[model samples]
Target: MTEIRFLHIADLHLDSPFKGISSIPQSKWKEIRESTFHAFTNIIEYAVENKPDFVLIVGDIYDGENRSLRAQALFQKGMEALQAKGIPVFICYGNHDHLSGKWVRFLLPDNVQVFGEKVETKTLNIKGEKVHISGFSYKERHVLEGMHSHYPVANGQHIHIGMLHGSVEGNMEHDVYAPFRKNDLIAKGYNYWALGHIHKRQTLHNDPPIVYPGNTQSRHRNEQGLKGFYDVTLTENNATLQFVPSSAFIYDEVEVSCEGIVHANELINLMEQSLNSYREANGNAIVELTLTDISEETSELIQASSKEEWLSLIQESLEMDHTFIIVKELHVNLPNMERKESNMLLEMMEEWETAEWKHVLKDLYRHPKGSRYLPAIDEQFMDETMQEAKEILSKVVTRGE
Candidate 1:
């Protein structure tokens, strides 16, 4: 019953441009740009302190196809730290950081084991217990075939781990690269499956623990909440996993209800209080403020000719803690006035929900070039889109009347 511990991290996305946060001052911009490196350093420091048997980075060490020299240098530095500690690091290059003939490669530490562009297996012996790690790196931008089928079955004598960097079957958010099914992975009889390429953390299956550690740092609002790695401990009979937060900054959305706020001062006060709540929380976070259930006066302030003036006022009065709750953008959703069933806007939404709407868009869907970019106009999305359109229409109709 030998126990082995390892850190599982994926989608480091080192040297990301931080395009969304580019509007900040140069001083702040420099900090944000280096945030990814800071996070990777944290992972290394954590490994140094914990002395894990190995560190597993599933993929996408660099953000783009043409790897940046700085990113490679920073990654080598982390590997050097682990190498000094006599710990091993394993990596499988993902879609974004896939191998290319044109890449100017840098030498990694001796202790680092990077899977090649073909499916391969590496064995490790820790404390007299044998462990088998199997995976491959992407040779090109997209490895669409099911690579899981090529994975070797786990020999019962050793703990087996599978490292894969691709989308699970049917996940449309990401391109289908190295696509695999949960059942296929389970059938491989591996003790654990380490997954990557998806930025949102998820555990597809728990029996043998198919885990996606997500990305080390989130660059966009779509990627919200805590971003970090997983500390995994495996024994002959049991496996345990604990999440470790490594991100220096986070992106979050905070919604403030303007239901009762009468004066602008009162609204500002409520927003300030909300911002204050993030002060003692984990790390620095940029928040997108969304004001819902807003009163008619606030609606006018947001939509009238004085809209820019009101926005400037809100931004100016926003008392940031300088450490937390840094305001980024504001979205105002005006309260819907009580309307009768026969309201024109409501009737319009009902019409949008009808089959006739699909018929109207049929030509657009059939267009050779336009259809590729458009998502299949499914009923659920149609319902949501129509409702959103109705909200905008209601606002305009109310104002016009």
Candidate 2:
């Protein structure tokens, strides 16, 4: 009975073009742009220091199929660092950085073993223990086939790990790629399942230890809190898992109560107090602030003074503090629609919902030259956009200007 340790990280999304975070100028602009790179470097440093038996990078190593030259260069550098420490790395390309993508393809160190476009197993003998890893790389951007079916069962030797980068079937939220279910994985009787594609860390099964390490860094508000990898220790009998936070910055949403607040000074103080209480939040954060439970007078006053003005004020106040907290977005949620003709707003929303919003969005992205730069339009994105649109319209109608 031998115990082995490894680091499981996925969805690094290196050189990710962090859209929506920087609609306007930001403080520490250089750091914001390089946060993704910083996160990967931190993970590599941790591995170099701790000296793990091996490392597993499941998928989505780059932001896109056509990975940027900088991403490849930095990735190679990280692999080189691990090679120096005698740590072997296993990798599989996800839908985002599929094999079909065109790139100069920087040469990685010999310590790195990337799975091909077919389901295959790589066996490694480390520290008097045998470990078998099974995985596959995405040959195309859309891997609609049930590729998980191809994964072979455990070799019944020492340790068996199955690495996959795809969404579970029946997941309407994310596009289906190499889709499979929990039962499908469990049926194979693997020791552990290391998964990617989803950007929030979660554990599906505890016994066999099916898990997703999520992404290395937080790209936008949707991916909140500390983002990092899973430190896994596997024994013949059980598996112990611990999450390590390594993201340079985190994207989070902070909600403050506006119940009894009236004046901007009070609002400023409340926001400041609320902001201070986010202790778990890393030093650097791009917060999407939501002001909840507002009075009609407060709402009116807020509208009278432009929303941008309030955001600017908050942004300026935050800059005074040492912590780099930038209020990238401000949403004022009205207490109740007690104003006149509020029914019309609801009607408008209903109509908008009935209309082909996705169709309209598809048309907007029809231009090949322009579509390449657009971020993915998932259900969450549409919901957020719709909510913001409603809020904007509600402001216009409620103000009665």
Candidate 3:
């Protein structure tokens, strides 16, 4: 039995800027862009040191639109290094890297073989071992049907491996692109499946392992958790797969509760301690803090006049000496204290349940004019305003009394 080892990576999304991450400094944009290339270089270095049989890139080599020339050049350079070692590369186009025009073609290394628009299989004989590889490209934007049906089943005794970029049937919002099902692949009897398009690494089967190697670098906050590639070892008996984390920066969310806190300074201290503990655990990870269940006292403490001062303190403490550490997002959920008291406010709240009151309240909140004017009115002002309005002629509306 021939021992076959290979590296699998997907969804590099190269040349894509980190959008909506305003907390990241403008100077670090270049470093962030280069980090994707650095991760790819590390993969090549691993290949050189460990000597994998070949490398498989499932899909999304570049961002979908507005790809940069620099990204292409850097990708080629990394591939060149791998080619120099005589390790072959196989690539398939995911939705992001779908070809748009004829002028986009560049001369790739002779060792790289890119699969085309059709679902076809290529067989390569490596050291007396037969390896059957199959894949297809996305010619257009949306693929609502199954592209895997076109893949031919494994024939003879060769070790069959298939690579495609698609979501299996109804995987959350991923049902649009090359939708397929697990039973379909299992019935086809492929030795292994190298899948992509999903950014989270997951394995579907064990006997003849079906895997989603996931994205090489995370692109946004939505693509959270550990980001990396896979190393697969193929044997006659069974195939073994391992995930390797290669991301230069990790993205995570941290939640802090201020249920009983009375002072902003105390809250800040608690938050700083929480952040310190998180950094100690994660070691150089970017975080977004959500301050939830903030008490009435804390809310009153952080009024409009002192908001900047508290924010400044938070910024200073979070800065520290770590260059990589950053607070990507901060949100506060103020407690609803009015709900606890039973008085005229509670009666008004109960009145909010009536259809007439509900309709009037919804219109008041939804309409721009009503929102702008309603908060400034007293009881007499509201009565006069409602009398003049056409929509609230019959509704009994009351304001602060």
Model 2 TM:
0.81
**How high is each candidate's TM-score?**
0.81, 0.81, 0.79
Error of 3 at 267 (Å): 4.0
For candidate 2, write residues 82-121 as lDDT tens digits.
9999999999999999999999968788999999999999
Q: Which of the two, 1 or 3, has more TM-score?
A: 1
In model 3, the worst 10-residue window by lDDT is 392-401
Taking the tens digit of each residue's C-alpha lDDT, what string does model 3 give over 1-401? 59888888888888777777565655556666676777677677887887788988998888764457777887788889888898889998888887552234569898899898888887777889989899987786576769989999887488888897898787785545998889888877888899888888889888778888778766567777668898899888978888888776677888898778886568878888887787777655566777777667776765544544555566667766445556667766543533333234434534443455546567666786657765543455455544454233222232110
Which ranges in model 3 have alpha carbons more than 4 Å from their true place?
Answer: 23-28, 102-104, 257-266, 292-313, 336-401
Q: Which pairs in model 1 have colliding backbones? A: 143-178
lDDT at 262 for candidate 1?
A: 69
> Candidate 2: where are CA atoms >4 Å away?
22-24, 279-282, 296-301, 337-401
- Writing each residue's lDDT as its tens digit, candidate 1 over 1-401 gives 58989999999999998767653434467777888999999999999999999989999989998888888888888899999999999999988888873567888878999999889999899998888999999998878889998899886778899999988899889888999889999998998999999999999998899999989887878888999999999876788999999888889888888877767677778877776666455457777878788767766545654544554555555433354346677767643433432276567656665477778788988999988998777787687877787777666757633
Would you list the C-alpha lDDT of every candidate in the order shown? 0.82, 0.85, 0.74
Q: Is candidate 2 or candidate 3 better by TM-score?
A: 2
